[model samples]
Target: MSKNRYSVGLIIVIVGIILLLGKLGVFGFVWGLFWPVFVLAPGLLLHFLYFNRVLPSAVLIPGGILVTCSILFFLCTIFGWSLMAYIWPGFIFAIAVGLYEFYTFDKYSPRGTLMAAVVLAILSGILFGVTILFTVGIYLIALVLIGVGAYIIFGKRRSW
Candidate 1:
């Protein structure tokens, strides 16, 4: 399928699932919220495979791995799993991405990549804090905004 067609179908499925889960209850809502990890990791790898000739692999790979790990951590926490083992790896992925972006800024779209990294770092902290504090309202807001930002920034269709 064309990239645009695939992206549109993905978006429609995601939105449909979210709406269905939201109508169910807290558990469904929570599950829907953390579902993106399963969506993103392969999506990133696929993007690398399909579009590398057009866009640098470095630009998308680290961000994809970090996002995938982070989302896995969140889902684990929701399932009452202790995230101690996963946390450090996720943090490392994030830091590696940040450092990579910093060091390679001049090689690509420096401003956009750096800004995205900074925002993701800040957001990772905010989401971790809000989750730990049991701040559901703030967590939901931060989560939604991050979700929207990710879709806009990374989705192949450029929904933004």
Candidate 2:
């Protein structure tokens, strides 16, 4: 067989296999769950370019924000959209991450930028804590009570 014909035959086989897999829903399942990778890719590329000196540090701002938001989106996609209620604070943190990255990578970085990042991070943490507690506090309280009762019944007493 001619090399051109042989290569064409291989290409036809690969295409057939790909189509078969597509019909089986493999591609559908992957694309449905991992679509955030599309958002994450540019963020990662920007960071890579900055570190390699191919781009200015300003690019890190969007890079950091995209990376953070993509992670939040990926978490929601994998765990369920309902989890977004508890992690909504992550949006604020994403901007903070972007600002912080800029402050870190830029030689003329301003202290106010760092301050803003810190404040946003702290606010995000507080909001996340509040949301988690409100969402699941009852379960935690129940577990604590159960543990205390169990310890009283079965654990050894310590010196008072």
Candidate 3:
């Protein structure tokens, strides 16, 4: 995949899927975000570490923190220590990375778009969570997903 491959149509499909899942509920949103962080993060980090020699420390640090917190949150939830797990903080970390890449778009080399996707995914999860509080959350999430998708497809700006 070239960095220049701007698949607006593919992005629309992804956004549509996200919105549809959002309509499902909080569980859906949580699951949607989990796959990216759990799967993508590791692969991306490994690629950078092995191919770029950029060192795994940067990605692994945050990755470890997020994973640890998530596990603890799950444990707490299972043990009845908390009403529900608040995983937004992990999303916040991902957003921070997104901001870094967004600001230094040129310096990020090949992975800039992927970093932005990380941010969008995290935001989508949070939106899904918030929507859970109200019955309309799903509709709101769908709208947000559509808006972001449009921005990504047409804006041409590095930051999504």
Estimate the lDDT of model 2.
0.95
- Where model 1 places Cα greater than 4 Å from the true spot, the runs are 1-41, 50-106, 135-160
Best by TM-score: 2
- In order, the Cα lDDT scores of the candidates are 0.61, 0.95, 0.55
Model 3 C-alpha RMSD vs. true structure (Å) is: 24.4
Between prediction 1 and prediction 2, the one with superior TM-score is 2
Q: Write one digit per residue (lDDT tens) for candidate 2, span 53-103.
A: 999998998999999999998999999999898999999999999999999
lDDT of 2 at 23: 100
Task: Name the candidate that leads on lDDT.
Answer: 2
lDDT, candidate 3, 28-72, per-residue tens = 657644543554556456445634656533454344444444554
- Candidate 1 local lDDT, 1-160, one digit each (tens): 6999999999999999977767778666666567666655664664555355665555454555556565666666576466653344456446546445444633545456666666667766766765555635667879899999999888887345
TM-score of each: 0.32, 0.84, 0.26
**Sequence-dependent TM-score of model 2:** 0.84
Whole-model alpha-carbon lDDT for candidate 1: 0.61
How accurate locally is residue 96 in candidate 3, as Cα lDDT from 0 to 100?
A: 52
Q: What are the runs in model 3 whose C-alpha is more than 4 Å off?
A: 1-82, 85-106, 114-122, 125-129, 135-160
